[model samples]
Target: MELTINVDETTRNGSLLFKAARTNDTGAMKKLLESSDVDPFIRGNLEETILHTALLNDNKDVMEVIVEMVPSLINEPMTSEMYKGETPLHIAILKQDINMVHYLLQHGADPIHARAIGSCFIPGPYGQCYYGEYVLSFAACLENEEIVTLLLKHGAPLQAQDSLGNTVLHVLVLQPDKEMACFMYDIVTSFVTNKQKHKVQSIENSNGYTPLKLAAAEGDTQMFNYLVQKQKRTYWTMGTISYCVYDLTHIDTWGDHKSVLDIITSSKKMQVRKLVDIRPVKELLHHKWKTFGLKYFMLWMISYIAYTSIFTAVCLYRPLKRMPDNQTDNFTVMIQKTLAESYRTKGDYIRLSGELFTIVGAVVILASEVPYLARIGPRNFFGNASIGGPFPLLMVAFSFSIFIAVIFRLLGMEQESIPLSVALIIGWCNTIYFARGFRMLGQFSIMIQKIIFGDLLQWCCLLFISIIAFSSALYILFQTLDLTNYPYFRDFQMTLYTAVELMMGLIDFPIPYNNVTPSFIYIVYVLYMIFAYLLMLNLLIAMMDDTYWRVAQEREELWKVQIAATILLLEKRIPKFLRHRSGVPGITLGFNDDDKWYFGVEEIIPEEKGKIQAGGIHMAKSVGWEVIRSNLARIANMKEYTESTPF
Candidate 1:
């Protein structure tokens, strides 16, 4: 009797075993394997043997038939192109098929297979990284506890290293995904032995980065803590920390000018520091943030003076002496009493608090800035513009007006400025003072500085020179014209102001001269318009456009430096108790930056290192002036600014 098994036409490229497996036909698979003519171990173009094909397709029935028929084929490594030298067991692991892997291992498959059937490699920064999902790494990558345990039970190599020297534990520790890290942690603590685990943990990749080091560099603080704690390493001794802190670019693992610590610490973000549990680093960052809040609060309080003074002067202003029992017909007086008087409205305490707040803010700002005003001039203070600025002047003005009008309770004055209307003269000054605070950021600071100072300064000089040359000729020529009634040509200041207005298009076009003016005066006016509008104005516009793009390109570096300055300024203010404790079991890391801070033995290089004046609110500009904020751009490396520094 003969057994007939009809295989599908898709078996041309694959074996009958794979075709039957795809269809889940156990009968056909069994018949084909039992027949004498068909070889159970025959391979296709990709070197996928019948057993390999069955495993690849997740065909349970075909896989079962092949395993029973050809026991020798189970562990046979292929010689084909795609998965050369990898056996069927490796194929099962790649598929992450727990049941197939269990069946294969039970049916004489080797457990310690390093070459997983379809494992991959990717080009890293240095060279090829073992990025493939192989055996234990495949199970670990999937975060599959059951498959991992099953593999471990069947004696899979726990210390298996990939081509790039990444151990199974290395693969596990580097995964930033929380679930994967948790599973990897569980595998290390439970499955791997202490001796074997330490050996694998110490294995460094070709780039000389260990698993914990890679985790730290990746800024996966959770993974870093778990792996580092297991190694009994602390903040100071961790490879990632030391590599970053020491600026060890000499080492193979130091990938850039920045270390892992630099990348982590230099970040302006608070959340990055909050997520990690690295002993003293978190404390150090906390102090920086605390100082930031304190500085901002102090500045806000100063600005609040201007706000409250103007608010209360208009809303709560009143004559200290009661209104006279006199005028009944004065309707204007009645309206002023009803609307502008504090007692004339809802709540008295709120208005009183507002007035008091303004006075207190004024006093505080004056106390802080008055002594240093001689050294740090008003221009410098306003241009540092962020924390230290001419906000004091506005506060002082508002406070003086309030005191002069109603007379402060502390002062002995009765009636000085009288109506308090004098204080409201510069009420709009508060908006300018407050608005400049937002300009501390590099984006706005650079853009506004370039436009106002760089381009505007140049344009003003050109306009002044042009107006002088053209206005003089006209003024001398029209000396005899009847310009007595018209102030436009009678006085030089008036002529200058009118000329500026004309240049700015505020005056009529086509040169409006007095009817008595000479004909040569009209020629001078035509030449003036041609030069000012046609050439000079367009030149100014082009120059401003150029300045905008140039500053925009540098905004990122400027921002980084600005952020670093603020942190360095405040980080030094942290006392001993605020820093890491010395007596702990781990080594204490001290943070300092070139005598800027005396706190610690370890220091991070500031983003604007050696660029700012060490101990003052002064950034170093041209001529090494301590406080003068100037946009003197040294154009030495302007062309090379965008080029990569090949180290």
Candidate 2:
């Protein structure tokens, strides 16, 4: 009675069960599926499950019977012996059977459960587990999105990375289908919401590439634009300005210290480069003016004198003008008193008049010299020199004139004195405009090749400077021509005037002007006040913004260097035992086969070398490794490898 099943008998029994299921023999398949005497997860010779064989053969009746008999087996882990451990679900997905996938999903098959098939037969590396085979890769391999959606709805993690480090979004970015990518986004959103957890929006692959970066690298402009806009709004709060500050020890979500902005800026792709170059031109202009010119000199002088004169005049004259004369003041005493008051007033007026004359004198000198300096003729009016040579001299003269005017105006001049204050303010304003114009022209000279005929970046910078200069000059001229009388100027002046008057109306004083209407004088005063305030404030703010961005860019570069260093360190520190086994013929060097072996370190090092250590062997080895790794990693990670490989 010691009956034992032989190998032949076992094989025959399994074959009979698989054949019955494949041929839609529901009665036999159900008997086999419900048999307690057999292993429910068993597979036949083709490494196919009875259920998998039924699905492959399109035996819907057998599949339905199996599902009805053992619903738990619908999501059961397949036996390890069949097809090197691939689950029944994996087999159905690989066969491209939408109906089988739907049935399996409906019956509770886990799409996210990965099985480890042999490396020789697996689409990716051995032990590779993707989110689901239903997601297409870059090769346009077909996948069922509807089924994937169903799995995702049932609590599947869309952001779960495969062995190759690609999420559903990552895979969709590689595909050419727009609808697929949008659908993937929706699925990911649902996964996030369902899980009540926030996944990293920009997850990198094994090769350290985010979905956006991949799109950018592939030149998928439409997808790249959409992702950038979406991410920027979501993460950066739609701020028009952004800065990347780098620290050597600061690691990003990808375990590197390099800033995303830096990576984008240095990318060889033109689109990424263009996006990173969108810096604020106004800020740069502020830094340039502050660092390299007479602009600051003029500004300092104007501020110092304007503040001192306005303050001193108000303090000294306010109480005196309001004082009353006593009856004790006799005719001679009254006359003497009157004479003294007139003398004091006349002295104040004379001092202001002198300052006004000095400012006007400087303006006249500058206007006269500009024509001479700008004139290009055989006879050198400014001397035997090119226009370039005398240009600097004119700038110096303009700067000096501004200094002189500012100094005189600060000597306690009254704000209400029409002739002197008007002349002085107008002259200083003109000088500022001329100086700025000349400086800009000089900048144009230096960057002429770039601005007029070179790349778009320089052209843009030039265009920005031109716009600012033109607008500022127009404003100055508008003030000078007494055009506040015109409807447009009146309206323009009113906006700024109204704002200022509302803020400082209580402290304001009346101007002494009989010829010009009070309304016209009021408009002129408001125009100057607003112009000075806005110009100075805006320029300061711009300078600060430029400095911040410059520092940020520098920091970003440093961070990148640190990241590269860390990677190099890791590469070097990789124990020889753990290094990738070389498959190349001959010498068993761990280095990539295509790497050029050079004797000099300078030719191969990943980093810069000192004066004396440029040709060291260690540098050469390190550089060779970096070059080889970068190239090979890209090739090894590409989707083409999976499609082209026999596996």
- Local accuracy by lDDT, each model: 0.53, 0.44
lDDT of 2 by residue, 1-647 (tens): 22455565566667778778878998777776666555555666655567777777777788888777767666544444324545556666666677776777777776555543334333455524333232222111244556555556665565567656766677677666766675556555554642232244457777676676666556566665566444221101012322111111111112342334334423434344333222211122222233322343455346535643543353234212422356443432221122234335666676556445545545655665555444333233222211222333444454464454354334433332443344334433333222222423322232322222233344346434543443343345446545435333334454334334432434352322343544544665555445534554355446555544543444433232222222222222334442221111111122232221111000122343334221123234444444434433332222221111110
RMSD of candidate 1 to true structure, Å: 24.7
RMSD in order of candidates:
24.7, 25.8
Badly placed stretches (over 4 Å) of model 1 are 1-14, 24-31, 34-36, 77-87, 94-96, 117-132, 173-176, 225-280, 284-647
lDDT of 1: 0.53
Q: Which candidate wins on lDDT?
A: 1
Every model's TM-score: 0.39, 0.36
Give a tens-digit lDDT track for model 1, residues 1-647.
13223243334424666678667788988887777666666677777777777777788777888788788888887766445656777777768788888898898787676564333333355323243335667676667777778878888776666666776766776654766666665774487665565556656766555665556555567776565434321122122222112111211111233333344433434333333336333433333335343465346547555575555564445424444558545542332232234354455555666666665655664665465454445565444432324444555565567656555333423334343555555454454433332335445654555576567877889888999988787678656766664557776766777677777777763234444556787688788888886788888889888877876775554443344333432233334233321111111112121211111123243244233332121111212332112211211111111112222
